[model samples]
Target: MKKILFIDRDGTLIQEPDKEIPQVDSLEEMVFLPWVISSLNMFIKKWYKLIIVTNQDWLWTELNPRENYTNINNKMFEIFAWEGVTFSHIFECPHFESDNCKCRKPKVWILWDFLSENDIDYKNSYMVWDRDTDSEFAKNIWVWFYKVIYWDDKHNWWNILEFVAG
Candidate 1:
């Protein structure tokens, strides 16, 4: 069975833009969080399959153009590749909160196919994210949850490394 690390993109892997609805609209707005690359490298070295699970609201809509999203996403992948950190899969929900889509975070509908196909070690697997919905998602999937407080100076995102080390 494979131990997977389900990660969130915005605010967790990258610094979320401070807006009413925080989203990385363009390449210029994309900024990776501190210690993200190194911590991900550690996870990869520990033999964890990295999976990105994120909610991208208004995607492909006029509000959030698909081309813009693709450009920004591709750049993020390129940077991660340069750092030797690669994601096994990326799952995104492009529905708004009002849509109440089954694929949204806290719902496992989008992951059902992957869950059925893979021999996952849920006991050792973890969900690392930055929101309450993400915590609920971990509970919904019956996996360990690690909440990342991006602005916490004391942690500075080092707790994840410590957790993985232990």
Candidate 2:
């Protein structure tokens, strides 16, 4: 079984816009945070299988078109591919919080589904995210959690490397 690093997309990897437009709605808005590529590469070098689990509640409304979301997400993949940091899988819950979706953050269904389908060492796995929901999700699945402070200028990917390394 391989150790995995379950990560969040928005805020954790890319900076999130203001609450009014909280998502990376377009390719132009899809930008990686400082040292994110380097930090992800460090984990890759260490042989951690990366996976992305994100909640896209905005996708439920016409205000945020699904096509735009797909393009922006594809852009993220393209950017990461250039640096050789490919995720093993990416899971997203498109339902809003009110939908009570089983795959949303704070729920273990998505992670459990992945675990059942893969050879994962839960004891060695960790969750890297920027929200309390993600933290709760990690706890639900009994994995170590690291809440990346996306709002702090000092909390770059290098810091994440040191945190996991130490």
Candidate 3:
């Protein structure tokens, strides 16, 4: 079987833009982008593992980092419970952009780690996100298997969800 798909939550699946997005440990702050519910539902039926890959610079910069993490986690559980979307994993990069860590997207370490742990097939796996940085990150790590899908109408990012579901 092909490996499961990895996804980005902010902007791509939801609209919590980089600046406004909290730690994302909670559901209230984790709002979905338009068509996210339906689009992801389709992928579920296709038997793909819908994992959410995110960058959480908020945790590192929050006024009270530990408390911020606590609140965010509560919100995330609540929101997911309501939305009925169970993620295989929620990998986050809590470091600032300057941290220059390899776990960040475009870097393959995390996804590669996920695949290694689960024995997933990279050849059959794919990634979807809505930001230039994320696209660049996934591409840097996964290379040809990564695809950037436009969330709305712009071609600036290609919509791999549409292509795969169709």
Point to the candidate with the largest lDDT.
1
Each model's TM-score? 0.95, 0.91, 0.72
What are the clashing pairs of model 2?
none
Please, what is the whole-model Cα lDDT of each candidate in the order they appear? Answer: 0.88, 0.83, 0.61
- Per-residue lDDT of candidate 2, residues 19-135 (tens digit): 685878777777787788988988989889998999988685787788888888888888898999999988888888889989888887877766777877878788988878788
Model 2 deviation from the true structure expressed as Cα RMSD, one decimal place: 1.7
Off by over 4 Å in 1: 154-156
Local error of candidate 2 at 3, Å? 1.1
lDDT of 1 by residue, 7-119 (tens): 99998999899998787887888988888898888888988999999999999898889899899988999999999999999999999999988999989999999999999
* Tens digits of per-residue lDDT for model 3, 1-166: 5456677765566555345444344445566555556556666777777777887664655442767665665665566557665677888776666889877776667667656667655565667765677767656645234434434463212245566555
lDDT of 3: 0.61
Candidate 2 regions with alpha-carbon error over 4 angstroms = 151-154
Lowest summed lDDT over 10 consecutive residues: which window, candidate 2?
Answer: 149-158
- Pairs that collide in candidate 1 are none
In terms of lDDT, the poorest run of 10 residues in model 1 is: 153-162
